[model samples]
Target chain A: MTDAPKAAPATNSRAGTKKELSEHFKTYKHVWVFIECEYGVIHPVSLELLGEARKLADKRGVSLAGVILGSDANLIAAAATVCFEHGADLVYTVTDPTLAHYRNEAFTKGMTDVVNTYKPEILLLGATTLGRDLAGSVATTLLTGLTADSTALAIDDEGSLAATRPTFGGSLLCTIMTLNYRPQMATVRPRVFGMPPREPGRRGEIIAHPLNLAEDDIVTKVLQFVADRDSNQSQLAYADIVVAGGLGLRSAENFELVKALASVLGAEYGGSRPLVQKGWITADRQIGQTGKTIRPKLYIAAGISGAIQHRVGVEGADTIVAINTDPNAQIFEFAHLGIVADAIKLLPALTEAFRKRLSVNRLAS
Target chain B: MHIVVCLKQVPDSAQIRVHPVTNTIMRQGVPTIINPYDLFALEEAMRLRDLIGGEVTVLTMGPPMAEDSLRKALTFGADRAVLLTDRFFAGSDTLATSFALASALTKIGQEFGVPSIVFTGKQTIDGDTAQVGPGIAKRLGLNQLTYVARIVELDRDANKIIVERRAEGGVQVLETRLPVLITMLEGVNEIRRGSLESAYRAASAKIVTWNAAAAGITDLTKCGLKGSPTIVKKVFAPTPRAEKAHQVPTDGLAPEALADAVIAEIFSRQPSVESDLVRFSAGQ
Candidate 1:
């Protein structure tokens, strides 16, 4: 089917839209976050978003609402409770069987329908795979603006959502404002904002809505879901200690040096984004803006130049040690400790040394 | 079946240096290459073309210089290249970009055949938004399959397409129909090197150039910054941390001794790490 021709502006200029658009959107109030729920589990990024959304909602003197779409009633209710405990003032839920799986069709329709009904001034979603999939379509359906992978979000002085994100491969930061769009949308990566403390027994108003979507209408069918097995575990995000390699590792074989250190220290091993693109590591083990955002207690980098993209993902570490031959490597700027040496040679020695220290400590104990 | 793959010319980020004084990106001397992610999409499109009896058309929306990227795609055996360039498209955000590109695709469909599938990278390194693909899909009323790791099955006669999409903690094997927009995941496939014949063909191939109006974009206000709802209010570099890392002198020491000194320093700074390391070893 061909797209129907879109209606053009009557005034025929950019200046003609803002005043009319803002007035048109005057009724759009409150900040709403789409609580990402699939199967029976609610994504942690949804809770984190509610925390950030609460701040934006409070800044605008409006209610914080969390929109959850799921097939199960108990799961939706449970997620709504968690949302309320975190920060949401109310919850909007659309329960339907088609919503059980994250199909772009069902979720987008469910989210957009609720959004159109409630008229939220600002909407937020986690920048997870599912969130990105739904946000792109929803924003397009609503003909609004969406800033993806925002590192920081705030309410501008004029009461607009100012979303700041890394651009130009994370070398630069830009603040984007949807000046004329109601329900200004943006997606934030996991752990970009701190999770708020949950208040036990906190209750909120729950508003229920019908999905009005049938299984037949959805084009994409989920044939199966192969959950990541233990053998393929790459829990880099939650690891207490993380050891990562970079392009400086030279070859995939050299990357084993990084894995050796991590194995010795009982740490999770990962590499930079390029290593993933270069097939040295899986996408899950990539440490950068586009990959996993890690918050480790101790992070050790070998031969990583630590670009801004990689820096944002690891800045939350309690302690970071950077090992590279170049003293001027960007990783040194934020790292707690710096060692100027070739990771290839130093990694094996470091692994041996760490193993000996651990064994010695074990003997003493 | 006609397939259109979107390519972008992005600065080689490794060579991108920020001006120390102004903290602005130094564009000079930095080479431009086809977005690395787009290569996967182009390769996937070409593979489909090779499997089925069809042609792969590479499309891009950028400055006139973007023709270089289009030429590069042609070297990969694309049947045609279309460069959608216009002064009005400058400073366009994702929304505006999708508008222009979707319009161009429409024109392409009218001129060529309707594309069975439209392919794009999961995200551009420069924009990194990954929104434009879905935006185009929505505008064109096409089903979108994003973050697709593999095209498991394709039956053109049945108009069925099944793909493995990488989702949270799992792989969702999804089945959809034709007339879809797909954003191919990186590292799934390697881009093939161009043959000598393909290289010669690319060097002489004429890139189809279209202005906004020529691409049937009548909305002047919707072509560029004017059409973009999101405005970039500020551009700045991330602030460097106040405290630089404490240097561990590796002057004359071997790797082993240096490792020992590093361990001591870490333990001295954070006494808790020593206890934690012991616990880790004990658990192992």
Candidate 2:
């Protein structure tokens, strides 16, 4: 196999001979969202997309549909019901025994089958592990386009999907339009969109689809799934408050002081991208454009310079408190409260004060 | 077995300075550097090739200047380097970029031995999309694994690779067959320096530059903006918040007193937050 001389590109995998759009592609209507469900619980990002899809649906004057794929019929039904509660007008679901765990081949086949049968003009998915894997495969199978990690989505005057998101490492925002592609696909991060209110009694039509896949046909297997629910695993997305450290902290050992403040405040602790790259913290604890996006009520930063990459994740906080020695650090520009002091010195003082005050309040109550 | 690593050349984003007055990028003397994340991928590919008997070829889709990055990969112990470039491929989004790269890889596979494994960075620092790796895998129909923390086992005889894939909340142990694509996570392993002999070879090696047509791109429309569906309508900066930071009066104050002052300031602003904190801490 190694002896062949390298030459021209080999042709395979949905390489279209023609360049123009199909008239059928123009007929594609409605907003469809892929409902990402794992272990009987639907991923929250899917519900968030339904909320966003609802707005796009309203703008386009079309129905909103949620597409769910799984092995268990009952689980798929439950997901469809939840999708309805989250403002889906209808649901197209595919159920099969081979679809239990997220295998790319099965999910792509199921999604492509549903999409080809009932076309959608706009499609959204969560930028989760499963969603990214499935979206890329489905988009390739369909020979369409997909924009990843969009921060904003809207229907423009020409009836195209306008997806806006931070680009070039979050230094600037760019609005992208998938004008020529049918089923304009994009993935949104978890916290970028709102969680739609669930109408408890709301119901929608559930159209069942079939996935004729067998176990032997799948190439990959999920050997085992171990929950990484360790105490240190980050919970920044749902935290009430977050304490983050950045390159300004200087040393890996100094990052612990950030943790001390988080503990005293009962908040989640995280670090910027450089801290993670320096092996000071796990990637899971990294907060930035490339990492987790947080919307905590209060985000306390100690020694962070607040680069635009890090700013994108923490800007959603209600009150940003930045503590840095540099008076003119970028963080102070956006921080609701700024403290010009050494984080090493100020963290201990803040930790002690918070621990004492909170304990006192606890005892009094 | 053969391995192909995809890399990119990005501006050294760390050194870019904003002018104090105009807030415009200070591009003077800002050097082009290979994206840091791709180094991890290159290193992982080299390590795998070293462990088993195979060759590692580096690939990139960029302008002619990007040939420098491909040569750098050769200096880092790649067996060969290929640069896929064309004027028609300019301003291509992830979709067009992946299409061009995938065509080049198919060409690479036909020229060399079919690659058993393909590797890429988790995402480029500039694009930050992380879509190309999966896109290539899907187009090639390889078992795609993104955000791989570690390569646990590679049984060549069995033609299987097991990896620890990083997900949203946990690490998933996946066992997949050969001809798989992996997007290496950062900081997992440090990149190694090129040997003296390899560095010398890299200095003299002629990089194979291919245009879109030579790469067997059949559709010209899909080669650039025509193939790309995502059109950039506008670029803008986020508006700064109306209100600025309200610094607590801590000038000349002791540490303990400063903490107290900040606490008082916060409590005065939000009474509900204090009560919620107390209730949460007490687990009520």
Best by lDDT: 1
For the predicted complex of model 1, DockQ is 0.49
Candidate 2: deviation at residue A23, Å?
Answer: 3.5
**In model 1, what is chain B's TM-score?**
0.95
Tell me the number of clashing residue pairs for each predicted model.
0, 2
How does residue B101 of candidate 2 score in lDDT? 87
Query: Candidate 1: where is the Cα deviation over 4 Å?
Result: A1-21, A230-234
Any residue pairs clashing in model 2, and if so which? A5-B111, A6-B111
The window of 10 residues in a row where model 2 chain B has the poorest summed lDDT is: B17-26
True lDDT of residue A272, candidate 2: 90
Worst 10-residue lDDT window for candidate 2 chain A reads: A1-10
Best candidate per TM-score, number?
1
Listed per candidate, the RMSD to the true structure in angstroms reads 4.3, 5.4
